[model samples]
Target: DAGITQSPRYKITETGRQVTLMCHQTWSHSYMFWYRQDLGHGLRLIYYSAAADITDKGEVPDGYVVSRSKTENFPLTLESATRSQTSVYFCASSDWGSRNEQFFGPGTRLTVL
Candidate 1:
């Protein structure tokens, strides 16, 4: 597989619980990103990593954490899930920069009850 994958594809958890969503890519792309897409809205960046050991927060990084210790994997964790956190989480990767074409994974639908 030369693309990205995310799991679990769907998750339902109670509020205040911690959950980690996994993302994996085979291309070892230089840049990886985590975004959440709510209904009828554009994707909002949560976190991103330039390369191994290099990570940064994006526009809506609150309550979310990310790490890129490995070049091909970036995981996102919700410290304390809230109803607002319930959305479709998409994982994407690019060669570099915001202008680079990004490839997206199927996505993880997280529901916080």
Candidate 2:
């Protein structure tokens, strides 16, 4: 497998602007998730998908994503990015046998200006 990956290792955007972080994996995991890392909040779940068109919103972030149709790509879009959204975002995937064990991407560092 090609393993998990996150694009745009770093990004800078102004408030009210839009930003999209891309994630991909070759392992074809059934479960995928997006999370943001911050000091007080730690790793906060933004969104997740159990399969291709099946998705659910997490505790934070207004993001749009889909799997299966794209094969392995999961893109998260911030319709209007804000300074409060600045953080390191990560993507993870887990297989059927090990739902609790996940493989994470390198992470994308986004800075909202």
TM-scores of the models, in the given order? 0.95, 0.91
Q: Could you give candidate 2's per-residue lDDT for residues 3-79 as a string of tens digits?
A: 99999999999998878889999998988899999998999998988888778889885644434456477888888
The TM-score of predicted model 2 comes to 0.91
On the 0 to 100 scale, the lDDT of residue 29 in model 2 is 91
Go through the candidates in order and give each one's C-alpha lDDT: 0.94, 0.85
Error of model 2, residue 72, in angstroms: 0.8
Q: After aligning candidate 2 to the native by TM-score, how far in Å is the CA of 49 from where it should be?
A: 0.3
Query: Candidate 1 at residue 102, lDDT?
Result: 97
Off by over 4 Å in 2: 63-68
lDDT of 2: 0.85
